[model samples]
Target: MHCYIVEYRAYAREHLDGRWPTYSRLVSLGKAIAPAGPVELWVLQSGARPGSDYTLLASKMTSTPIDAFDVLPVECPRDNVRETPPIDILITRYCSMNSKAELIALARRMVKRRPLGRLEFVGPAE
Candidate 1:
């Protein structure tokens, strides 16, 4: 089995009004997919706000190490209405961005990791 890492941000919705499922929700989603295995955490970073320009860091309990990440930017309809752009769910699964190397190195690393695997789908966040 392969491991995964995921991050989220709000694009379509405004920062104050936008929303993303909680960590527990993600765990439940993972568990539903792979009932018998363990889902480890490499790193989980949720910004203070959509564009608050701040990051909140938490320590992992065990660190089994996440091999890849699947980030989904969800844009749900308000009052059962959908707009243009059709709510993009850009799915990019790649390795963790190393903090030491700066932006250029990080992008390079992401490119190298991309061909390894990719998964994109339209579904509700657990």
Candidate 2:
């Protein structure tokens, strides 16, 4: 299975509903650029670091820690049939903090994994 690391910045504005289309586009890009393999989405919050962000986000979204999410240890017999890890494409939208360098560095660390571009942020109210 192939994994892609995506830089995400959550924000209060930006509608926050268009993420699905954006995610789909990135996945399509990956499929076109990379080999035909399973992809999984790994989202790292703007404030969270690389090693732990996946776990944190997963926990908040699924109520399960990253470590516990590992199927190898769970010993689920149906693991083989599970859908190809949903193209680990990171979809981070509305980040107000973090410099470009930090985001770039994080994106580079996972060169093997695809790095979808950062999500745009809507500025403060006028």
Candidate 3:
């Protein structure tokens, strides 16, 4: 099945209600964009790297669309916070792949370009 990686940053891990804003947004966007495919959302925290220091906030499959609320356990303020950092969202799509090397290469290319608020497609390696 096709997979989409939705990358974004977050200042606060969780909202006042203990729900992850990024995860919520990811599921919403995924349903809107690729309602029939698997969607993975990655959230990068402050002072964190792209591929390494990121959290798999949430993911949804075509079959289990209702179970997309899965999120990492993160602590946050109970009261309203101020001066939160801005987060940029980027979406990258990977077609069916046969090997792990192709996935690694495509991820490297994505890290280099860091496309923002756009869709990128990486077909299977030839």
lDDT of 1 by residue, 20-70 (tens): 543211221121111222322111334333322212111112355433443
Tens-digit lDDT track of model 3 for 34-113: 23343454343323233233322434444643433333333222331233345555433223323444433333333333
lDDT of each: 0.30, 0.28, 0.33
Model 1: residues with Cα > 4 Å off, grouped in runs:
1-30, 34-46, 49-63, 80-126
Better of 1 and 2 by TM-score: 1
Which 10-residue window in model 1 sums to the lowest lDDT?
Answer: 25-34
- Clash pairs detected, candidate 3: none
List all candidate RMSDs to the true structure. 17.2, 18.0, 17.8
Candidate 3: worst-modelled 10 consecutive residues by lDDT: 24-33
Clashes of each: 2, 8, 0
Local error of candidate 3 at residue 34 (angstroms): 27
**Superposition error at 1 for model 2 (Å):** 38
Q: For residues 22-124, what per-residue lDDT tens digits would candidate 2 score against the true structure?
A: 1111211111111223323233332233323222111112334323211111121232223434445843332221444443333333433433333323443
